[model samples]
Target: MSLPRARFDQFRLAMMLLTRLPVGRISGAVPAMDKARWAFPLVGLVIGGIGWGVFAAAVTFGLSSVIAAILALLATALATGGMHFDGLADFADGWGGGSDRARTLEIMRDSRIGSYGVLALILFSALLAAGISEVASATAFLLAGVGSRLAMLLALVFMPPARADGLGRMAAGKGEASLIAGTLVCAVLVILAGTTGAFALIGAGLAMIVIGHSATRRIGGQTGDVLGAIQLASETAIWIFLATSAH
Candidate 1:
């Protein structure tokens, strides 16, 4: 059965954003640039829901806080297939070890993880696990996920592409319209959930802007790896904010 045009477009864009699903079929149906521009944050909301549902279920089942947090992280990783983790590794290897832009790009292009990448991944994942464990409510967990993705959007808006090709380039210059739309949708949902998601949103936005600027200068622009790094870093930042406020 054929779907409505608008819904189909959203689904197609979501497919591109969520999974590493090939976009060959829908390549001509819509502009890749436009879809990539809007879909990233929208997919984040879906992923956030998945993470929150798992956390809520765990909480309802009388699970320990540590177990619930582990389950939530597992749910998110399964849903996104650790795409951002891969980005984090690449960014760390490139930025931490390379002596020059060409060298950094080459290191990032390498398929193997390096010492710096391993250390970065370990540290970041440990922090995430700890942060999620501190969340007392499912609402806060969900907001953290959504807020983190919004940070990713902010990164996309402010950071220059590291290269002239790849996913970052397609999404660059797409502007605030798509990001704003996604933000509004997430905001409304967060409000409906009876929590002040506004603070998380503001914190995430500020973190993204600051990090994006520094990252852009460090790498001379954004890359797919940079985008991933942004998500990973922003997610951690959001979680940190939530944890601090929870105290």
Candidate 2:
């Protein structure tokens, strides 16, 4: 296929995998998950745009900052089908409740949510909402959204898949080209937010280290749940930095 066509297919695939949005259909041969990794940040941009729109609209309609933040949060959640939230919950449940690798994997695979999962969701969701409410910058939202996904791409490229099968395994082994491409795209998005991106980048880096190391030590490598957990943590970190520094 032509280069541009291939890129288009990859973008469509990335959107399809990352969000619940209607991306129509790919015109020709579908690309592998690895090939589509470059567009992950693009998916973040789309989500951030949705969030910015909702928050702006809510605020324009005379909603309080908290209400606007919650509305924006809900919009992004709906856009992404709440998969990241579910991942965070599963990661917490598996990590907190399990004693060994096999047990952890088993817990994560279970459909039922546990106490650890509930607490994890509540804590992270609260942080996210609070941060969004405090920092009302469109640039902050866009930067955080893109930074979190960049963190995901980092884990997928740098870490091994914990299991022999699953989304992580299938999406693993992405080339450096994809990583570089995603990073460049992410850098452009972050630069648009000015120095605030520096703090957000620190947050994303810390999240990648903490989540990636813990996942590696506990379950041997990264998984979809781990990636999801990382995204949430990174996003929260970005928001906190933006909020605290907004003054």
The regions of model 1 sitting more than 4 angstroms off are: 1-4, 20-30, 189-196
The residue pairs that clash in candidate 2, if any, are none
- Residues 1-247 of candidate 2 have per-residue lDDT tens digits of 8898889889899999989999898876789888888888778888999999999999999999999999999999999999999999999999889999999999998979999999998898889999999986778888888889988988998999998887799888846777776577667866787787787789888988999999999999999999999998999999988887777
TM-score, model 1 to reference? 0.84
Task: Give one digit per residue, the lDDT tens place, for model 1 in 1-247.
Answer: 2446554666567556655545446634564554456666667666777777887799889998778878988888887888888888998898888888889898988889999999999998887778778864656665666667666766667677888787777777747776776677667756854444565566666766765776666778778787787777777776766676667
Off-target runs (Cα >4 Å) in candidate 2 are none
> Which consecutive 10 residues in model 2 have the weakest lDDT in total?
174-183
C-alpha RMSD of each candidate structure in angstroms: 3.3, 1.1
